[model samples]
Target: MTDTTNTDEQDPAQAEEGAIMRFMRATELDTRLLGMVAALLLIWVGFHFFGYFKNGFAAFLTPRNLWNLSVQTSSIGIMATGMVLVIVTRHIDLSVGSVLGFSAIVMGVLQVNILPEYLGLGHPLIWIIAVIAGILVGALVGSLHGFLIAYGGIPAFIVTLGGLLVWRGMAFLIARGETISPVDSTFALLGGGPYGAIGAVGSWIVGLGACAIIIFLAWRGRANRRLHGFKLRPMWAEYFMTGLACAVAIGATLLVNSYPWPKGIVRRYAAANDITVPEGGLFISHGFAIPVLILLAVGVLMTILMTRTRFGRYVFAIGGNPEAAKLAGINTEWMTVKIFALMGGLAGLSAVVASARLGSATNALGTLDELYVIAAAVIGGTSLSGGIGTIYGAILGALVMQSLQTGMVLIGFDAAMQQVVVGTVLVLAVYLDNKYRGATK
Candidate 1:
């Protein structure tokens, strides 16, 4: 009789496969992303303990501080997503901060000056109009830079560098170096104060919905692979991934719900609504803020755009090899224009968030923000060499950058020290990314 000892399972390679490798393959998780997440956790915990040792309190990991961090990350996170696309296409936009400042100043002028005159103060349509105008302005500026680069035969670096100065100058000229204040009431909600957050019930609903989507996506991916006769993950692996995603969603919901509105805000709300406060005082949950939701929505849509659209494919193709892409009949110049335009529009939206949060607009509204946005993209694993990046990675990178800054602030680091730390982290991220690429190759 033929020996049927299942020798294939006992091959040397199979025998030597470690548990970690098995798990990685089973889940198809990106090791680099896992490392980034692990690093983020380490940073959080390190800061928490450091604070506890110095100030006798764990300030970095508290729900209140975390919630604020999320809000602070939203604007940069939004812009960083666009920056990924730009970087993926082998380009950079040094003018993003200037564009944001210009956009915010324009929106401020509209809401506080122009629109109010036309639609009357506090008109419901004023904020919407102002936002639309801001986005358009940003897009226009981006398109101009793109035009100069693609058709005008100017290099992207010079064009955008000029734009950085030009847009800021324009913003100053328009606002006359003056600060604009008291934006429309409804528009201010996008900045994410206590009232700007969705309550506990809404947060729970969002979390559960997210879980449902995660499960559905996993199921659909599996089905597609089965239909194509592609290699499939083990059933246990599938379950594990789904459960892990669900757990994260639920955990985030719980964290947001754990943060309560300030006592003063709660008291004011109770008095306004004529509700009696219990002896223990009110504990109104300040669930996910509007800006956070906006960031999430942007992440989802950008992910879809990158992974499920022809434009995204073209972008990667161009980044992989510009000459080949051009030879393949891709309209490289037009694509460049569109990409910059999108980046500009995103910068404008970020401006809306930033100005709204501060309830004002100034020439310096987004000063030095471009550095953080670019750092976030680079840190999130976008290859500076081009053609490799992810929207989710950029967003996570933004969070990481924000966390670092926030932790330093909480630990009493001065502005100069913070910049030093950020610069060092960015260099380290790039170095690690290079090493990772070499190893994978």
Candidate 2:
């Protein structure tokens, strides 16, 4: 009671802060991420209602379509992560589509023709060997391009543009312009299908594990902040974040579990297992595809690489100011080569998923993929001017781009119209990015 009535002036900044701004600050949420999420939700809802009104069925929001959309997004999403680094460093790789096709062709030839001859058909080692070989081929191609740009003084644009044509031509030559089919059964599973999915129980396990990890990470982060004498988020904020992440994990698990295997597949599965079908039809969840898992793994690894490594710091430093970075003792030239090599390796991995998904390899497998990859990165908020990007952003961008195409397809838009719409969106994304940057400045 001695000085209870005494008052202190409120801080000017706090006094001016609005409720939305205060909430954002407390949660430490990324505005860009929130914007993208809102946009995606809008797209999903719009497409779902449109489909319902037009066709008397809500096709877009169905489990079947969403599951298929995730699979389709896998290839482009895989490549889009690497594209973030490339664009963040103020460079471009026009050859990723070509590289994917070329590497996929190499993997196909090895599994279908060469390895089978040496290791015999259905050899356990064939898939592993082919995968490794494809990744190496991609890395080698990327390194060569990086070398030309960093050492030979050729511009990245020129180098990758030349590579685009060269690699496609090389893919055609490798297969003699023919498709390779009936890949190793084990390898085909990597592409994803009923056989390639993890099922309901596995999905639940993964979801719970993810939730656990999220909570642990959040706790550790707070501990580290305290240890380093940095400010800590309020307990409520910490709980909010952890809960949000866990909810997302659980929700995704529910979504994937809700989509049952097709009736034909169920019948075949039951016959193979010697089980009688129930009257209502057997229910088998296609919980999550192997390819989707692969994409998630890549995203986690890339996020770690970018956020918790010296190599990552170097990449951002170079992107922020190449000349200054070099002057500060960073080996910018070699770093460029390494970055490109990583991009190439990812492209190779994407090739594996793409060709495996198709159950065959064709010289035309990755046609125009470059356009999608770049657009995804850009739409996710990677700055072409350099030094700003996030791995998750690119993944979300890839999903958005794929969602647009899928929604259009569901509504019966032809290939030409799809391309036009995608193109317009890309331009709009760029314009928004520029405006956002300007306003922030």
Candidate 3:
């Protein structure tokens, strides 16, 4: 009883300070972000070493190429974003790849024979219906897995693993073990067609406008939070970072647009026996698939859901301490089910986009896609234990994976070797994650 109360209060304050210090010391710079930046730099360096470094290589980094990169990454990127949310809640979905294949088959079957005859729909209507159907089917399948894991109390790994096999078999069954090709032009355009001149201009305008709005909202949110006595990063530092990001966006737009007809290339035979080149009609890069834009929009929406919604908060809390969260009146089980359903819906959308791009449906359409999506998230620094991650981080992770694949091919690496390298990277990432968790504990 010798001033025990005073001793307790003093110890608490000291303990808080110690905890803060420990966190600051333990926190490492985001290696994934650094890795992406490094990978890009290495790509340039490799080009230089290979005697391909020139003004032309700079030209290769055109609006089209940039657009293509965005589009190419979108299908898997969307699935990966959803995976980020699931993993943050300490769950996994191996069925996404199979879900994609199954959804694609569904769409393909509808378009190829069912819808036109049954619904009497035209190409446009059929395309729209097929996409919607694929999404619904995906969601339904995801819910099944969620139910088994949540109310049924099955492990996520087991449920999704079984789902993977089931869905793949369904896809093969739907297509009768044959490939579906020559998809309608309306469907093909979603993946392979350009947005055209007006669409291109519209895209640029919308992109810039969206960037401005994001900057304003972010700044306002930070200021409001600080005014209300909420903990926040330093105001000046936040402002400086925001400004830098804006500057980079503006600079990139100008640089990409400066190239003359980079998106359109034409080769002509001259009367004098010398080949002459002329700029063809303006066109965007093959990477700018419509599905890419769809994926990006979905990513943004999911990010808002995870960071700004109550459900998202519950997800983190449950992952961190389910028992404590349940004690606090959180519906942990329900939330987990909803999240899995959401992930399934995303998987369905990804499959549609990918299939539309390829202009065909096949059982092998989504083969090993899970590996890429999971690798992207892991490399992007999502905690395996859950309760910590970001959409931006996942997207960066996808970029890194895609870049590595694209670069390796450009450098003439064989398919088998590429697989081995990717597999190695994935193992290393898991090992690092385990090490980090051990240290933190």
Candidate 4:
């Protein structure tokens, strides 16, 4: 007994190992995000070759393709941001597609059919009212779902599943199995169509503005942390991250600006106007579609909500442990209601964007969209078990998934193979997450 030694403290290797473990634990989330970036790069490179060699074209990496990807990703990206919140609270909304479809149908009917027929409201006024009304419809539907689940004591899965069928049936009845066309031009401007494009100059200006804001925020945050005596990342690390963010902003702007107007379209427009081509004018296509801006706006707001607000922390806490949360005086039911309502609202926004992009609304508007929205969030590293996700990562996940779809089509892969690959990737991603999560624990 007198000879007992403190082997734990005496072992030099133990200190080094403990330090390494601490660093690993601190960096796990950052590591996962970096891995996602690397995976996206790999996917892009693989698809670039597949499309170029297999399809005998190099369109996959062009600015035109990139711009299209951004637009296509925006719809799902918007919905996925909300889904991250939903799933983080250990809930899901299977009815988002149907909700989206019904909202768009309501807006189209009001704007194109009822408003003009009954009230004769001005075009701008009709568009404004229709948008607000559509969003309210979404919020209402979301509240209904939230109420049924929160107050009625039904499981979220069952509640939203029922909503899926009910809302989809309602959409069919509302549209009478038809499509509505020639949407209000004013409203369509939000859809990333030609009317919605933020011209090349505007895109550059916005990008620079965003970069400046990002830099300012970083500096301010670091300074605040120092003032509070909080630990900070290495100064060099902060500098590198800020530089990287700026490079990405500038790079994306340049990429979009590189795409010239399609040759046939340019010639047709020029001929229609009886205007010369200006002797070698580049005729560059517009940059940064409006939908991209919408996504960015939503993303910024969501990032702030998740990273800087008490509501976000409560949501995570509720997800991680409901009973523990209750013991700590959390009102989980009310929070769940709010979360689902928010999801519904986002679904409505996606509906507006979808309808605007197509310049019409149909009963089939958002069929299967729920799958894509959920996949985007899950693939972006949002754990299905809840309490973890990020808006930016989900947005990137949408882009990556959409890129796969676009690339597969370019390489002539059929729809079945696309589904198969997507399904496999989803399973693999979830498995990896589980393994990584358990190891960290």
RMSD of each: 3.5, 4.2, 6.2, 3.8
Q: Write the per-residue lDDT of candidate 2 for residues 136-250, one digit (tens) a residue.
A: 9999999999999999999999999999999999999999999998788998998999888899999999999999999999999999999999878889999999999999999
- Which regions of candidate 3 deviate over 4 angstroms? 1-65, 118-121, 195-199, 230-236, 251-288, 430-441
Which window of ten consecutive residues has the lowest lDDT sum in model 3?
Answer: 263-272
Candidates' lDDT values, in order?
0.94, 0.93, 0.73, 0.85
At residue 326, candidate 4 shows an lDDT of 77
Give me the displacement of residue 426 in model 2, in angstroms.
0.6
Error of 3 at 263 (Å): 8.5
lDDT score, candidate 3, position 427: 84
TM-score of 2: 0.97
TM-score of model 4 (CA atoms)? 0.91
Q: Kindly report which residue stretches of model 2 are placed more than 4 angstroms away from their true locations once superposed.
A: 1-10
Which pairs, if any, clash in model 3?
68-287
Q: Which 10 residues in a row give candidate 2 its minimum summed lDDT?
A: 1-10
TM values, all candidates: 0.97, 0.97, 0.81, 0.91
Q: How accurate is candidate 3 locally (lDDT)?
A: 0.73
Q: Write the per-residue lDDT of candidate 4 for residues 171-217, one digit (tens) a residue.
A: 88988978987788888988985547877898899889989997998
By lDDT: ranked, best first = 1, 2, 4, 3
lDDT of 4: 0.85
